[model samples]
Target: MTDKMLKFVKIGQQTPPKRDVGDRKDDFNEIYDDFIKQKAEEQSSRCSQCGVPFCQVHCPLSNNIPDWLKLTAEGRLKEAYELSQSTNNMPEVCGRICPQDRLCEGNCVIEQSGHGTVTIGSMEKYITDNAWEKGWVKPIEVKFEKDQSVGVIGAGPAGLAAAEQLRKNGYKITVYDRYDRAGGLLIYGIPNFKLEKYVVERRTKLLKDGGIEFVHNFEVGKDATLDQLRKKT
Candidate 1:
């Protein structure tokens, strides 16, 4: 495992290929292409695997970065994806949207050491996308359903995360959103160049498939009061 790491001394940082500007002008789809398997492995192998992993520390979610990167270098992608998702509910979403330069990748130890920082965001994206392609990303399986139900207002990022966490703990979850769709800002605010609508749609679908319910196009203040929502829940 040690032999697989510390390759940043020899390897330069790299990200996924970008679509041709001429072709991109016509579509609202994502600009960066997915990293091929070989590239993902090679880039992942560049991790310094330092005693103190500043990348994980600086990440808002504090994900287990080095372990997953090591797993990717070792060709254990399922394990890598598992570790990545353990701390982050939506690795793929964060990979695409998170300003990693201001956070995780920015605080990388090797970047300060003069070797370019590891392509952490791209590696995270690759791991999750591969997991989705291989069917490793699955709906949560609750062993027991609790009697209590939770009402999450607004299907924005925080609300959706709260709903998923509650559902994981066996509570019945019902997400109420003003829009016709589940993802509030992800669907209406962000552009496809940064985050495709399908990604948010698929994640919301997974929550529904896991037995969570969604009440769309229902504004709380207009439709009902807080007390009424509580009673409904």
Candidate 2:
């Protein structure tokens, strides 16, 4: 199995199949189809297992790409998802929007050798999407709840990521967003085709279910001043 796994020198690279441009432009749905079990394995098998992964070095968050790819190739998807999520606050979001042609996949060692780059972004999306479908994506599990609470002013990526990290550390988190939904740009700015609304909703729901409070349609200055919140907290 190990012998077969390191064959990027021989095998060609392949990415996920994308929707037709004309068809995809009509609506805000995912442009690419989800990787099938077999397809994901096949694609993962193209990894060169390089000694120094240029992909990891080039990644914004320096994710453990080769390890997670190996896990995915071996059909250990849940573990792969966890590994993928460790560094990335939003693997699914990054997978959807990240320009692979410019980042990790583009700098892949195998790609330099003309075998083409591993489809890192697509595989990431596959892992997270599979995790969600299988109910493997769970909320932050706090070890001990803290008495003190935090107020996150925005529901953007930074705020959400902060809230998740703090919640995991047992801090009571309260996210206040002006919109009705929790995700800031994720809910309104990004089109549905690239990232479906339900996917974002699922993560938000997990945070809510995990006891992180969300106050929607609440602006800091409009609903309550900074002074008022400071006193309340």
10-66, model 1: which lDDT tens digit per residue?
A: 788888999999999999999999999988989989998978899999998999999
**Model 2 spans with C-alpha error above 4 angstroms:** none
Name model 1 segments beyond 4 Å from true.
Answer: none
Candidate 1 collision pairs = none
Measured over all alpha carbons after superposition, the RMSD of each candidate to the real structure, in angstroms, is: 0.9, 1.6
Query: lDDT per prediction?
Result: 0.92, 0.87
**Best-fitting candidate, scored by lDDT:** 1
Tens digit per residue, CA lDDT, model 2, 1-233? 58647767666677778899999988878888889988898888888787898899998889999989999889899999999999987898888888888999989888887778888899998999898889988877887899999999989888999999889889999999999898899889988887888878887898998889999999889899989888876
Q: Evaluate residue 188 in candidate 1 and report its C-alpha lDDT on the 0 to 100 scale.
A: 96
Which 10 residues in a row give candidate 2 its minimum summed lDDT? 3-12
Report the error of model 1 at residue 158, Å.
Answer: 0.5
